[model samples]
Target: MSGTIHSVSERFDFTGDELAPAYRAAVDAIEAGDLVVMPTDTVYGIAADAFKADAVQRLMDAKGRGRDMPPPVLISVVESLDALATDVPDAGRKLCEEFWPGPLTVICHAQSSLMWDLGETQGTVALRVPDHENTRELLSRTGPLAVSAANTSGKPAALDVYEAEEQLGESVAVYLDGDRVSGGQPSTIVDITGETPRVLRVGALSLDQLRAVAPDLTSDDDPAPDPTDAPEPKPTEDAEPTPTDAAEPKPADAAEPKPADAAEPKPADAEPKPAEDAEPTHEVKPTEEPAEASNKGENNKPDPDVRPAD
Candidate 1:
């Protein structure tokens, strides 16, 4: 029961009641700002107190991840969505209603009032309500946890408790073996922070399945309109008319110095060229490969479609 980091992790079988000693040990470890490996809906995850800055940093460090790849928060219930995130759009709510307690991770703008840090979240947080009952039961007591797949950054996600232990080692204080539940596929991820919901990575849920709930949902595969093809034509049509009209008035208003007024602004107009040159430097959303499952377990298989939350 020591809160200090354990040099050797202890594993316990979490079955039967939620109030078991194993659950208590896991809870105590989390509250003490220590890392705990627990079974999530998709994959076993290393969890830390989401509100604790040092604990969260330990999670990132254990996974060999930097601040850029912030771990997703696992909540106990749907109601906790509003408590962590702000401006949950109607589309986001509908998606959550249809797919929560399952494998759909939604990234929304984080609540500004909250003091916790989940790393370079860029004012947003990825949230999910896992479908596992025991996990949810533990979450009800622990509030929210900053969880990521229980493995090193480049390794495959751990499907069972032993796999988690092998990779995480003593960095974790406690391991709650929920014994690998069904649906091993990673959760499908959708980002609802923008005006429309876009699939960052497809996993347990399909793109078609998401669109059924939010018809406007788009995937990374969908081609973004070529910037070169769009505004250029409209500007061409508008610009041609203006010059023709300017020509007609040139004879009568030649003495008005209108051309001088117009030509004087050319340098100011050229200033935007650098901005136009800089626009293409931006890249699209990061694409994640499906997590490869370990061969040590027969039930564990490599998923080809969706990237894991880790």
Candidate 2:
């Protein structure tokens, strides 16, 4: 089926009497459950009514992709996110506030009540608010649309409407040519199903920019360092000592020595010395000898006197 192509202004003038025919045709085709190729801020995309399961299936068949890879839903306004997603985390809201109307797609838990099937989305939907005025105007009229890159599976994304038309051909009902889009990259996709938001794909929006709004934003390219897998920090000279290190006892050889003068005293009554004999000697015998001698001499003199008298 050879598709019809229409050239339109890059910017939509809502007030002008002359409306863009291409936009009108695209909206009509989407309402009829037909796919339309349009230019987004990032790249060319083929869009369909997200609520139309058959139309979404047809879109997958056209792209030669299976139901496993679901297409992202594109909305005109930020408010449409609430209608499609449920349990919107604070990080998801902040990301929308910072990066909506730009290149950023958020994956969130799908609203259980919504009657729509986006292939094998597994109760989750990826959504984005593109930064193109014409596309936004179309989305405002069409509500939410299931959109994917305008190329077959495994092929490079179509940067221009011509490339999209060349690849998709008659599969798409209407082609709105908004000139060559500076398709630098696609929207960055962040999955908010977990407690921490993780970047499934790195695209136009850098991880740094996303982190500014959601500090916990993570990337598949740069995964968070696991606490268990992290290397134990090596001890440094200036590093603070750990409790185990501080509680260690000192070596036994570091004790102080005792003084030499502090010895014990000896016993008092062990042995006694021999004392001299207590006798006093004198020359008193000379007096007794002199008295004997005097008696003898008197006797001798008396004998001599008797002899003289005779």
When superposed on Cα atoms, how far off is each prediction in RMSD?
A: 25.5, 33.2
Clashes of 2: 0
| Poorest stretch of ten by lDDT in candidate 1 | 286-295
Off by over 4 Å in 2: 1-18, 223-310
Residue-wise lDDT of candidate 2 within 96-117, one digit each (tens)? Answer: 9889899999999999999998
The clash tally of candidate 1 reads: 0
Model 2 accuracy (lDDT, Cα): 0.76
Off by over 4 Å in 1: 1-5, 223-310
Give the candidate number with the greatest TM-score. 1
Task: Write out the backbone clash pairs for model 1.
Answer: none
How do all models score by TM-score? 0.70, 0.68
